[model samples]
Target: MLSIRNLHASVDDTEILKGLSLEVGDGEVHAIMGVNGSGKSTLGHVLAGRPGYTETEGSVQMDGQDLLALEPEIRSREGLFLAFQYPVEVPGVTNLEFLKAAVEARANHRGEEPPNASEFLKQARALCDAVNLDQAFLRRGVNEGFSGGEKKRNELMQMMLLQPKVAILDETDSGLDIDALQVVADGVNGLRAPDRSFVVITHYQRLLNFIEPDYVHVLVGGRIVRSGDKSLALELEEKGYRWLEDEVA
Candidate 1:
């Protein structure tokens, strides 16, 4: 569903991603594991077309269309979703309002009219239930007073409601406890379908235990250096990333 080739990206004046390349097929989940400053987050930001990151070279394509050629909003509307590691808290915007606007925007992109209030609410309630979030959360400002885990759950809730074709989860497991992590994982697993794909960017291997990926990639020095199955994750966890550093060097 997504292909990135020789993607070199830099923020401000410093280069981050250097010739990163990967492919994610439909219905496949790929996990990107890397240490801090290894460009894992940069890859996600670049894919979503976030500002401050300049693509020095390479191409990112969704299906067969050039992804970097489109704007950020267009990327989201065109079935691309990125769940940030730190979800911003909008003081005045209720979660319901935010989600409705997103859902309507995506619907309009497909030449379909927005769902009416009743229909939208029904879908919202279903998504809320799927994420194990309460209806009360819908009435609150987006992540205003939410705990860390609550924020992650809210992010997953948005992903479930939007139903994007390719979802990029950037460190969704950072602050989640075991129970909360399972809830978020369940929400993600429920969204798995034949036409959907996922790129899960994380630091630890625990999340992989919940949502086993089709492939595990070790990203070092801004490039993918190793690719394997689930067992690779366990090996990385046990032996640490020294082997990856050696291989990349």
Candidate 2:
């Protein structure tokens, strides 16, 4: 469903991605693993059109559309979602309000009607239950005063509600305890479908244990240095990125 070719991006005048390329077909879940400074998160942010990250080369297509040519909102409207590694707190906006607006906008984009308040609330509460979040959280500000695990859960909630065609989760496993991790994984697994795809960016293979990616990729030096199936994750966990250093070089 998504194709990236020769993607070269930079931040603050320093190039961070060099000739990076990958393809994620419909119903595929691809896991990206690498050490710090290897551009795992950069690739996610670049795909989502994060501000100040300049793309000097390469093309990305969502389905058949020119993904990079659209504005960030347009990208969202076109069914691309990026779950942040660090979900920011917006103290004034209640979670319910934010989610309603987001859902409505996405609905409008697809020429569908927004759900009634009661129906929306019911769905939101059900998603909360699925993600193991308290129903009262809808009254709180976005990520405000939430613990680390709570923030990650909130991100997954957004992903579930948004229901994008291609979801890019940038280290959704970070800071989550075993219990929280399982809950979050369940949220992701529940949303799997034949028409959807996921790009899971993580540093460790532990996340894969829950989500079970269809493909695994090793990203190093701003490029993908290796690609394999789930067994690759286990191998990386055992051998470590040290062995890949020489291979990437």
Candidate 3:
């Protein structure tokens, strides 16, 4: 549902994503594996149109629309979601208030009516249970004072609520424990549908063990050097990026 071709992006005049290309079909999960500075996270940020991450060349299309032409909020309304590696805290905005606004904004974009406050809260509470978050957290500031795992779960919660057509998870497993990891994976798996796709950007194979991506790609020097089935992830785990680096070299 998303297509990226020869994408080149830079930050502060330093290029990060160099001639990167990827295609994600409906219902497919693609895992991007790479060491630090390999542009894994940069890919996600550029796709989501984060400020200062400039897309210098190439095209990104979401279901035939120019993804790069849209502003960040417009991109979200167009069904592109990016879950950050480090979720920032909004001290004064309560989680419930944030989620309600997001859901309402999406509804308005789609020309649909948003749920009533009570019903919305009910659904939010259920989602909190699903993500192992306490209902009380809905009253807390967005990700404020939340532990690392809790923040990740909060991201997942937002993803669930947004129901984006394409979700780019930027190292969502970085700080999660085994149990918390499983919860995040389960939440992702639960949202899998015939029309939805996910781009899971991660470093290790452990996250793959849970999300089970349909395709695993090795990114080196800001470009995807190899793509394969899940077994490729196992290979990377066993031998690390050195073998792949030599092959690419």
Candidate 4:
């Protein structure tokens, strides 16, 4: 569903993603594991077309469309979702209002009628339950005053609602406890389908223990150095990135 070839991206004139190439097929979950400064999060930001993360070389195509050429909003409308490592708070916009607008925007982008208020509210409430969030949260500002774990779950809530074709989760497990982690993982697993693909970025293998990616890749020095099945994640947990760095060096 997503294809990236020799992608070189830069932030503030310093190069990060150097000749990175990755292919995410339909129904595949690819986990990118790396140490600090390996550019795992950079890959997600670059893929989502975040401002200032310029793609200096290579190509990214999502479902055959030129992904890098589209604006971030256009990318979201085109079924590309990026769950940030640190979810920002919108103080005045209630969660329900934000999600409803997003869902309606997506529907309008697809030339479909937006869901009625009652149906949308019902679905939103159901998703709150699914993510272990309180129904009361629907009335609060987006991620406002939420704990780290709550913010993470809020990201998953958005992911579930958007149902993007390619979802890039940038360390969604960063601050989650074990129980909260499982809930988030369950939400992600429930959305897995033959038409969906995922790019999960993290520094630890514990997240993979829950999500169980189809492929595990070790990203170092701004590019993917090794790619394997889930067993690779286990190996990383046992040995850490030192072994991979030695191999790359």
Q: After superposition, how far is residue 17 of candidate 4 from its true place, in Å?
A: 0.4
Residues 42-67 of candidate 1 have per-residue lDDT tens digits of 99999888899899999999988899
Q: Which stretches of candidate 1 lie over 4 Å from their true place?
A: none
Q: Report lDDT per candidate.
A: 0.93, 0.94, 0.96, 0.95
Which candidate number would show the highest lDDT if scored against the true structure?
A: 3
TM-score (all chains, Cα) for each model: 0.98, 0.98, 0.99, 0.99
**What stretches of model 2 exceed 4 Å from their correct place?**
none
C-alpha lDDT of residue 68 in model 4:
90
Steric clash pairs (candidate 4): none
lDDT of 2: 0.94
Write the candidate numbers in order of decreasing TM-score. 3, 4, 2, 1
In TM-score terms, candidate 2 sits at 0.98
| Per-residue lDDT of candidate 3, residues 115-203 (tens digit) | 99999999999999999999999999999999999999999999999999999999999999999999999999999999999999999
Off by over 4 Å in 4: none
Ranking by lDDT: 3, 4, 2, 1
**RMSD (Å) of each candidate, 1 decimal:** 0.9, 0.8, 0.6, 0.7
